[model samples]
Target: MCFGYWLETRGHQVTIATHENFASFVRQFDLKFAPIAGNMEEFLQSKQGQRLIAGEKLKKEEGDKLLLQQLESAWSACQGSEVIIYTPLATFGYHIAEKLGVSCFFASVLPLTPQGCLGF
Candidate 1:
C-alpha cells in the first residue's frame, strides 16, 4: 500500500511482487505484481523458517542462505527497472542490487543495523 501510494504520488510505474493474499489489494492500485511462490504458512513449516520466526533458535548460515534466496527472488521481480529505491531495512535488497550491478538509493526511517554492517 505504501509503495503503491508513493508510486501514484510520484507518478511512477511500480511493480510489486507479493503473495496471493495481497494480490487483490495491490490490484486496487493497478500496480504490477509478480506473485511470489509459497506463503508464510509454507515458510513457517520449514524447520529453519520456523526457528527463525519463532525466535527459538538462530542459525547464521541457514539464515544467510534464506536471505540470499529472498534477495534473488526480489531482484528477479524488479528486473528492467531503471532505478531501484531500496528501503534501508532491506539488507538483502541492498546486496542483491549491488550484485546485479544496478543503481540504487536507500531510504531509512531509523537506525537499525550498524553503519558498518552494510559493508559500505
Candidate 2:
C-alpha cells in the first residue's frame, strides 16, 4: 500500500496484484487490486507450506520450484506494467518484468535484523 501511495504521489498509475487477502487490504487505499492466481490461504494451510514456514531447510531445486510457481502466478497480471517494483519476497515480479521487457526494481522495506518490527 505504501508503494502504491508513493507511486501515486509521484503521478504514476499503479495496479497491485497479490494474494486475495492482500488485495482486499490494499483496496481500502483505493489502489487498483488484481488477484494473483493461487490460493494463498490454502497454501499456507498445507503441510509443505507449514513446514517451510516452520524453517525446514529447502534444497535449491525445491526453492527454485517455488519461485517458478510464483512467477507463473504473477505473469498475466504483470502484462502492461511499464516498469515493475517488487518487495524482496516478490521473486515472481522479476521474471515477469524480464519477460515483458520492463525495468524492475527489488527492495525490502522491512529491516533484516531479527529484532526488527516488520520481520518480512
Candidate 3:
C-alpha cells in the first residue's frame, strides 16, 4: 500500500504484485497487482514447506527447501516488474528473480537485529 501511495505521489507508473483481494485495498490508487497463482493461503502452508523444515516426523534437508519455493513463486511474479523490491525474507526469491533476468532490490520491514535476520 505504501508503495502504491509513493508511486501515486510521484506520478510514476506502478504495478504492484499482490494478492487479488488487495485490489480493493488499493482501488483508489493507480496501481496494478499481479496475483500469485493458486490458492494463496494453501501456498503459504504447503506440505513441501513442512517437509523442508522437518515437521513432526520429518527430517530436515541440508538446505531450506521452503525458502527455495518462496523464491520460485516470487521470482515468477518478478517477470512483470521493472524492478522487484522485497522484504529480507525474500533473499531466496531475489535469487530466483535474478535467475529469471529481473532486477532485484532487497527491503526490510524490521530494523537490523542480532537474532539473525540476515539472508544468505
lDDT per residue, candidate 1, 68-105, as tens digits?
65666677877777566666435555666677678776
lDDT of 2 by residue, 1-120 (tens): 675777787899898878766876888888988776666677768886687789897677755765565667678668788988787667767877988999999867575555422322
Question: Candidate 3, residues 19-75: lDDT per residue as tens digits?
Answer: 455566656565666654344355446775466346454445623464455445555
- For all predicted structures, in order, the TM-scores are 0.58, 0.72, 0.50
Predictions in order: lDDT? 0.65, 0.75, 0.57
Candidates sorted on TM-score, descending: 2, 1, 3
Task: Give residue 83's lDDT in candidate 3 (0 to 100).
Answer: 66
Ranked by lDDT, the better of candidates 1 and 3 is 1
Best by TM-score: 2
lDDT at 71, model 1:
60
Model 2 RMSD in angstroms: 5.2
What's the true lDDT of residue 33 in model 1? Answer: 73
Query: Comparing candidate 2 with candidate 3, which one achieves the higher TM-score?
Result: 2
